[model samples]
Target chain A: MRQEHKETMKRRRRNIKLTVAYDGTAYHGFQRQNKCVAVQNVLEEILPAVFGDSIEIAAAGRTDAGVHARGQVVNFFSDGMIPIENIPKAANRLLPKDIVVTEAQEADRDFSALHSAKSKIYVYQLYHSKVPDPLLHRYSWQYEYKLCLADMRKALTLVTGEHDFSAFRAAGGALGMNPVRTIYEAECKQEGAMLTFRFWGNGFLYHMVRNIVGTVVKVGNGRLSPDNFAEIMQAKDRNKAGKTAPARGLTLWHVNY
Target chain B: MRQEHKETMKRRRRNIKLTVAYDGTAYHGFQRQNKCVAVQNVLEEILPAVFGDSIEIAAAGRTDAGVHARGQVVNFFSDGMIPIENIPKAANRLLPKDIVVTEAQEADRDFSALHSAKSKIYVYQLYHSKVPDPLLHRYSWQYEYKLCLADMRKALTLVTGEHDFSAFRAAGGALGMNPVRTIYEAECKQEGAMLTFRFWGNGFLYHMVRNIVGTVVKVGNGRLSPDNFAEIMQAKDRNKAGKTAPARGLTLWHVNY
Candidate 1:
């Protein structure tokens, strides 16, 4: 708004960080692909029309297909003088009903959505029921068998803190190929028929959270004990761990910056 | 199967009442129409095909287009011996993703979906926010204006007893043509940005619950006062009430049989 603030960036355009929320049921995922329609593709298709500029963007998470998000972050460079207050409502006007930009803030030119140092949180939801609830079938995994919550909580303790997560990682489009990560918290909460697994971490390897969930579910189901889960983590072998949970049950909750 | 027990009715079919839940966005209301795909048509189209018989069914509430329901009840006479426990899952298999048969039970021929009921409950959900929430926009009413909850609760008290609801009823489809109905319970509950108005009544007329919600919203928004609400009820004129709220915000929550 002021000339001095504009001069601080030296002729470069302003960077905007937007908070996004999406249902993700109708999307291919968060990352833009050539043939498939992703949340990124939807934003790319609509944001340009609103801003009148070709914009390149970066996202906090590249969620797999069928995965949802409530607090995903994105950043883009724009030369237009559109007010930040107008971005979210204007973007929603053109974007599809499933995806929406919730918040828009002008950021320093050097800030990034994926980088700039922060943690992230993800939640995995399960509908514990003898019969599937059609209402929750789209958003939660339906599990019919009995589960030991105490055993699952004990199994959760085995996955936290800094660890070499090679056992949990699955081959995917990860840039650094890093296997070590810092998990700040791992907890399970059950309310009525819905059970949620919350994970707060500095970073996660591909499929790490889901793999941990699968292993913990085995512990809860009595297929594997809590001590066995600790052994599985120590083995550092993907095959030794339980199967990876489905992407539909996982949601990227929030990104810390 | 016990043939003697069933044969006591003498060629009469048993009536089955189904507890149905649906996201009614794609439906043209609950009643069957020749031109559009209604929930009734979908049920009629699928149920007969599943049982190999032409079945006529009736519902407790005929929800409007774009309205949702959690506990809508429908009854159909059937000679088929499909297990009651298997009906819900079996019906869901044939039904579309939006509508689901949640529960089923066999009832005597005297039980009617529309008549042999004590009361019904309805809920209208409102999402209060300055910006639209994409995830909730489908099922909730997005309202950005300021509201006074105390005044709304007071306004709610004026509608919770037996009264001539001519001020609330819209003249359309009526067989008995009675304007008198008894509201058993009426209250407003707020959790964060979502406000839910719960109404339990012996019976409701055409657009009656929605009409009351519209008037309550007017009181909340300060466009109409609580005293004016009482005066409007006494006037017994449809023109004295507020505008009819949109169908998308209303849901058939439950039925007492």
Candidate 2:
């Protein structure tokens, strides 16, 4: 009976799952770094203050600087002193104005945000116009040339499915790690002068999405044919891809896990 | 013939009308203020640099701090050296990143953005949720309440048509000026958890739209019945009205000339 009580007490140490959202314009990235403001640093700073105890958190992905997030997930072990319903309010009061803890849930004690088995959705917005759109400037990239949606669709086909994405990966990216990733969904949706690219993949390299978007834009501009794009993909060379797209236009939209 | 040529040259000193948009989170307001940064100051600083000389300007209405603008119009007189088409690019290069000159056109020299206006449109955004939404923090107000849409719509009816809005005006509103204004269209539009209050009027008193929104929200939450709302409008007393909503939710949506 004593042993059973101890096991129950151990299970009571709750794993708190959080769905977070941030503007990311004023953050270095999602991970904590030296001499920089990160989303993790702020969350770490506030959690201790709100709960009156230090806590460690693990995020699903390390989003780059200036990359927004709507449904980024994180998890941490807690003593379960604060009620689940009040956790969001308590954390938001101490967090920065640009960062918000949108949802909080008590999960199994063994749950881990990083090791969850599923995919992620990232979105990159681009607009074509001579004049900059003030409202969308912080959230979208502005380009001059009008892109052919049909060609962009053709390019998107090359990005989907399982593949060795070394050609689309950036230099200095995750050394010694495999570059194989399966893209579940890749498409460009147009609304007026804006084009939104939505990408859902099992995993991504340091700059995989941005690099793919750049190459697809080249295809839309009539510079690269579908066969040429396939060549760039099979080349297994980083230099074969087009320029890396801007970070401000990218958003970590959702995590399927 | 000399007199006619002089008049033509005088008219050639054309007035440039500009359509402006801005994210007002970082600005004190649309008008110039001491010490604090204002959208007008940024525009004033950039205009001279782009035009190669000082240029005075006027806006349709002075938006409050934390208020955004999508179709705010401004006008200025200048020598037609910088070609009307090139003004947006030149000004945008010098203006702050938050403010944008979206459109520029030559207008009559007698045109004034503050005067010669037919109506103005203002929009207030609100979201109902228990937790904070980081992506919309700068663009909307989050309220924790289950609001009745029918009650909110009924409240909107009490706000339309020409009426003495002394009850809705803020303190120090125009220094004993006429409290009566004509409202052409006023309604509440709901899209999911988002509620948008649109107001079109010949003119608005200081804090008029915000005050109306607060009252409408009160009605939505069942604090004030539709009859109580109508009484507040007819009471012509600021004390009878509900509280003024936050400035972040307000936007100067458009100005019709």
Candidate 3:
């Protein structure tokens, strides 16, 4: 009877998941690295303290340096018994103010954060003003140009369908990886002097969204024609893409399951 | 004729005005202090470099420490002969990224940045969430409470007319001064998980808006009835008000002349 109780206890303690949000400006990335600040490092340090045991965390996506996340999903396994209601407050006390665990829930043992994500959304902000506003300097990229809104919208429409986005991938992207991705939606809108570009996709190639934004900005500024955007995608040449937009302007808005 | 020309040049140089914006998170306030970083010190250092003369700048309002500004107007007198067109770029190059001179124009000789303003608008942001997002830490105050939107709106309306808001003024404020001020409008709105409080008035006393927000928050949380807010105003006692909200959440949104 005692042996049976031990086995049941072990089975019940094996599942836990947490949804986190972080201002990634201060970390190297989402993955852990030696002698570098990463989101995983922060979680590793705080989760162990909260759970009273060393915990391994798995995330939905590994964001790059200076990329912020609003809804980053993470999962972990734990054996110690603690009320789930205390997880957010307990973890927050040990973690820095820039990393917050918004939700914690028990998951099935087979659940994997990375594999379970159905889609992701990213937002890139650009401020089209003659002069940069000091308040928005950290949150947006300043583009001092008169943008043609119609041309930008036209270019954005072409990016919505599934396509070989090799033209938008970075030159240093991984080898033997498929660059075909289905973009559910791509939209550009201007609110006052701020231009926001929101993209939803099944998955993205390395630097795909940033490069696409850079190309669309060129179209908005009349430097590149919107009609040529489709041709550029068909060519599948990385050199045909515009420059990568700065990472500071990019935000991981949400991850959908 | 040379003496008359010198007088005319001096007169023309004395009429200089600049519209400025600053991210006040890093500064003590708009005014200068001995051991603190202030917006005035930044402007003081850059003004002489841009105009090549000692200039005294008077602002439309004195924002406290950690308070941000978007359209804080200033006027300065300089005998230097630099073109008005060159002032914006030249000063911006010398100033830090947090401070910007958005518009520079010649003004009437008697114009004062503070006295010439007709009205000022201030915005205070409150994040009404169970947990604060890391990205909004510097820009908003996090409060965990279910706010009654109707009660907040009702309390906002009570403070919209001309009155002596001594109850809203900070304790130990200037003595023997009339706290009477005309509030053009006071509004509260909730967007998503954030609540915004905006006040437009001819002038504000020390910590007045923040004090008022604190009182309104009490009404919002049902700690104080909305009808009681008028009684608090009539009492004209600082002790009758709620706690003072932090300065970081307040912004000098704009100045209307």
Candidate 4:
């Protein structure tokens, strides 16, 4: 009877999971770095106190510096001793104000944060105001251009399909990684003075969404034509793309698994 | 005839008016002080260089330390011959990047920015997020309150008409200033995670809008009821009002004459 109880206890202790959101401006990225602010570093430091053990977590994606996340998923193995309902409150108290564990749940032992993702949505915000509002200075990129919404929409239509987006990938990006990806949707809209570019894809290449946004902005500003965007894509040369937009405006909107 | 021509030229040169916008994070306020960064000091230094004569600008309203402005109006008398069209560009070239002159126009000889008869509008922005977005760290106040819209709306109704707002005025405010003012409109709206408070009035006493916003927020958070707000206003004592909200979120939206 004692041996049977030990087996049941082991099975219940390994199914905990956590999902988090963070403003990445203060961290180097999602991964831990020596003497650097990182999402993982903050999580690791607090998880030990909550679970009473050194816990290892796996993130859905590794984000770059200054890249914010709204629904970034993370999973970890933890014992069932602590109630799952109290996980969010317990973690939040130990974490910095810039990061929060919005939700937590119990997951199967075989679940992995990386392999569970099916699609992701990203948004890039741009401000075409003559003078930047101090309130929105950090959340958006201020560009003094008369953006044409029709032109941006026309250019976006060219990117919504399976394509080897070599033209949009960052130069010297991850080696041995395929540049091809399937984009489900892409569009741009302007509300008053704020312009937003939203994209959904099965996966994104390095700097892919930002590069696409930059080229679309060029089309909006009359610097490039929509038809020319098609040509640049066909060229499959990274240099043929327009300049990359700044990182401040990019946000990981959601991750669908 | 030559003397008359010279007098006419001098009269034309003496009328100067400018429209300025500034990020108030780095300044002590709009007024000049002995040892502080003030918007007025920055303008005073640049105007003389542009006009080739000493000029004193009369502002529509004076903002406190850390308060921002977008449509601030100022008129000055200068005995110089700079073209009105070139004034905006010249002032922008000399001023810091945080300040900009969007428009400059010649004003009538009798025009005074302060004495103009019209309404003024102010907006206060609040970010109601569980975790602070790093990008918005300096721009908004991070408050984790489930604000009640209905209660806040009802509380605003009491202050719509002309009334002596002595209860909402700040201590050590300007002397002999009548607290009676007409509030033309007050609105509260929420977009995504942001809450904005807009007020249009014939005039505002020192810290009037901020104190009102604080009280309404208390009502929204269930700390003070809508009916209690009426009681506070009727008491006509500053001690009865809620605490002053931070200055960074307050903006002088516009001044009309």
| Most accurate candidate by DockQ | 2
lDDT of 2 by residue, A181-253 (tens): 9999999999988999999999998899999999898888888887788999999878877889988899999
| Candidate 2 lDDT over residue span B1-257, tens digit each | 97785455445477889999999989999998889999998898889877775766789999999999999999876674898888888888888778989999888877889998899999999988777677777888889887999999988887889999998999767756899999999998989778999999999999999999998998999999999998888888888788899998999999999
Model 4 lDDT tens row, B7-57: 554475566778788878789988887798799999998888999877667
Instruction: Please give the range of 10 consecutive residues that has the lowest summed lDDT in model 3 chain B.
Output: B5-14
A48-142 per-residue lDDT for model 1 (tens digits): 88788776678988888888888999988777788989999899889887887889999987888989648999999988887666556667887
**Residue-by-residue lDDT tens digits, candidate 3, B22-70:** 9898899999888988999999977987777776678999999999998
TM-score of chain A of each: 0.93, 0.93, 0.92, 0.91
lDDT of each: 0.86, 0.87, 0.87, 0.83
Lowest summed lDDT window (length 10), candidate 2 chain B: B5-14
Model 2: runs farther than 4 Å from truth?
A1-12, B1-12
Q: Residue B46, candidate 3: how far off, in angstroms?
A: 2.0
DockQ, structure candidate 3: 0.66
State in Å the error of residue A221, model 2.
1.9
Error of 2 at A44 (Å): 0.7
lDDT of 3: 0.87
Give the TM-scores of the predictions, in the order they appear.
0.91, 0.94, 0.91, 0.82
Clash pairs of candidate 1? none
B207-239: candidate 1 lDDT, tens digit per residue: 998899888899999999999999999998778
What DockQ does each candidate score versus the true complex, computed on alpha carbons? Answer: 0.44, 0.68, 0.66, 0.22
For candidate 1, give the lDDT of residue B102: 80
Interface root-mean-square deviation (Å) of every model: 2.0, 1.2, 1.4, 4.0
Question: Could you tell me the interface RMSD of model 3?
Answer: 1.4
